[model samples]
Target: MNNHIPILVEMQKLDDVIAEKLVLTESLPKRLSGLKKDVEDADNQVSETKTRLEENRKDQKLKELEIKSNNDQITKYKNQLLAAQSNKEYKALNSEVAHLESQNSLIDDVILQLMEDESSIKAQLEEELKIQANAKAELKANEDSLNLEIKEVEKEIKKFRDQRNNLAKDLPRALVKRYAALIKNRNRKAVVFNNGNKCGGCGYVLRPQVMIELQKGDEIINCENCGRMLVFHE
Candidate 1:
């Protein structure tokens, strides 16, 4: 049974290797997910800003048309006043010209406001475009880097699995089966340290008898609370 201690230690080392590989595998998707969200948010902001800029330009066009129509009316009313025979008709034509001028002035003011708004929006959109361009480049670079990293991690995981299979070949069927099952059910963390009297995996107080057995290091023992394989600490 004492000779079995070496085998138990080797098994724990294998478990550590597997756990580390699993951690590396889990990180890839999370990193990609977060970066993807950032890129998407930046793109949406750029699109919204561009839309506002375009709408301001359209409003400016409408104001221009309104001003032009008011100018035409003012010119027609002036001609009518010049040709008028009666005092009343002349006064009416003059009032019409004044009204058209007032309307044209208001439209001019509106056009100015629209032009200012358009200028501000264009500037904002330009900034946003620059930000989006930089973000797009960063996202592309990050994705490329992550793809390479993922490939390397997959290769390493494959290598570790191959090694694990080779190691399992020399172990007893019962022990291998137990280890595999625990790894599958326990977040890939099949092995845990025994911290003096406590099980590091579950914080459970190790039974005195179990602690003695662990000291013997003869056989694999599980933490009853968490069902994780325990390795005695140095």
Candidate 2:
């Protein structure tokens, strides 16, 4: 067996761990982003609810002013009816008063509806605030844990990478470069075994001569299809 084969296999083991931990460092942030999104959504809901409540109160205030103006006009019209000079004038004044009262009735109904909406909005705002609080709390907890995990994963990768590099010192420079290239290009796998008639890395069918050479273990061998170092395993 070529001395490089065993060293390559050992390096592959270290690289495997480094690669897997690197993936964790990436995915942990994505998980944190999702948690942040939940808090963001809750904040939006709370803001919207508060805005609705403010608008509802403003609308209620405007309607109250309108009712007050209508009442004042009704009192003035009543006074005019008392001093009316003819039946037609009194009838007209009375009709004006009735119309104003009808408007006031409709306005009252609208004010009541606005109050109900205000109540509902206040309740919704309370619930949304609670949700916002909970989301922030949950995010904080997970964020701390995920950030710690990311740091730990980074440390692990660095440790394994250093080990892998030190191990590579035992091999020739050209072989190490070739292995590194394969690892970078082949999804962090540089050494693979035969799986029946196929290459374990790419599932490329191995030729009979290729199988015989791998079984002999006389020298370093690569798969024709994938160019990965192949080892024989029963």
Number of residue pairs clashing in candidate 2, backbone atoms closer than 3 angstroms, sequence gap of 3 or more or interchain:
0
Which portions of model 1 miss their true places by more than 4 Å?
2-8
User: Candidate 1 residues 5-70, lDDT tens each?
Assistant: 455456567767767867877898678777787778888998998888888888888888888888
TM-score of each: 0.86, 0.94
| lDDT for each candidate structure | 0.80, 0.92
For candidate 1, the 10 contiguous residues with the lowest summed lDDT are 1-10
| Candidate 2 wrongly placed segments (more than 4 Å) | none
Please, what are the lDDT tens digits per residue for candidate 2 over residues 1-234?
877788888898998888889889889999999999999999999998889999999999999999999999999999999899999999999999999999999999999999998999898889999999999999988998898988899988999999999999999999898999999999989999999989999999999998999989988889899999998888
Q: What is the overall TM-score of model 2 with all chains considered together? A: 0.94
Top-scoring candidate (lDDT) = 2
Q: Model 2 clash pairs?
A: none
